[model samples]
Target: MSTYVIGDIQGCRDALLRLLERCRFDPAADRLICAGDLVARGPDSLGTLRFVHGLGTAATAVLGNHDLHLLALAQGFGRARDGLDTVVAADDAETLLEWLSTRPLALHHAATDTLIVHAGVAPQWTVAQTLALAGEAQAVFADRERRRAFLPRMYGDAPARWRDDLTGDDRLRCIVNVLTRARYCSAQGDFEFAEKGSPGAQAGDLMPWFEVPERRSAGTRIVFGHWSTLGRIHWPQANVWGLDTGCVWGGALSALRLEDLHLLEVPCAG
Candidate 1:
């Protein structure tokens, strides 16, 4: 059975369906790992969430920034953005949001030696450390009382550089930023939130997280999606694959086969 890693669906259910059909995905055998941003800003957030949620064990997802935003909205911490109201108003909204909250910030596919995250890992973190750190944030979501407090504190970009000594919300927020919102980072590994452009678009000394020299996680293959502006990059030299192709922005929905690096895509209806 093949394992397919899809980029941001962003509520474009039709495009996702077409892309899956093209891949000939079988729920019984094939596995689907989504790089995240499953719902938001497109035609059908509710339908998209239902389809992925229906996949059950056959599918797994990493939590993207949009996903977190949705979670926060669900908990009454943030304002509902356009296109997201459908999901919030759905009958199964609680169920769907709960499933999303349970998703990890990092997912490791052992057979492929690929670490899947919604955005990028901290340059200083190794594959093992990335997962461990992600777990810390995941634990917060799992705790009822903690989740209520945590979701509201989830919206900042303070403490741009990660430090071992950081405690409480600061630490978790940094981890979430690196895993979901990061694109470019300073040479010394500080997150550069404002530079969301493609590789060359950033200013001096700033580079894509995966391209950071001597990044500890560089040894393992990484599949990430947050930067749709850097669309469909397969930099084997860096062992990084960027699958987001701006499908929510009227581009194509894209996916990569874990075993062979073959690409499958379908133009978005949006």
Candidate 2:
């Protein structure tokens, strides 16, 4: 069986299907690992969620910022964004949100040494450490009472760096931001959320998360999305593959075959 790691679907159901066709994905024999943003800002958020959720064990996804937003909105903790009302209004909204809540912030496959996260990992974290930290955030999400209390506090860019001493909301926020929304950050591991352009677009000293010189997880193979402008990156030296191709922005839905590093893509209609 082959594993195909897909970029952010962001509600582009048609593109996802076409890309899967390109890969000849057979649910019976193939597995899909999504780099999050599974729903939002595209043609069919409800349909996308239903399809992905229906995949069950055959598909797994990391939680993207958009996915988390859906969870928060579902809990009445935030305003409804475009393309999300359909989800919140759906009959299966609760079930879908519950599935999303339980989804991991990071997924690591030891055999392929492939780590899938919605965005980037903290410079100070190893793959195992990253998963462990993710579990902390996941725990809050898994518990109904904790999740209700935590969702509102989830929207911020503060404490831009990771510290082992961090506790409570601050620690979980740091972990969530790094795993779901991080892109360029300082060598000191400060997240720069404002700069969303391509790699060279950032100012001095702000490098893509993986390029941080002292990044401890640099040795791990990370399959990530969330930086659409960065497009598809294959840097064997850095052991990072950036898969977001802006499918929601009228670019292409992209996927990478984990076994052979082959890429398959389908143009998006936006």
| Total clashing pairs for each candidate | 0, 0
List the candidate 2 regions with Cα displacement exceeding 4 Å.
none
Q: lDDT tens string, model 2, 12-108?
A: 9999988988899999999999999999899899999999999989998999999999999888878888689899999998898889899999998
lDDT digits (tens) for residues 1-270 of candidate 1: 999999999988899999999999999999999998998898888899999999999998999999888888878888889588778888998899889989999999999899999999888899999999999999898676888899999888988998989999999999999999999898899988988887887898998888888999988999999898994479877899999999989888999999988999999972
TM-score quality measure for candidate 1: 0.97
Candidate 1 ranges with C-alpha deviation above 4 Å: none
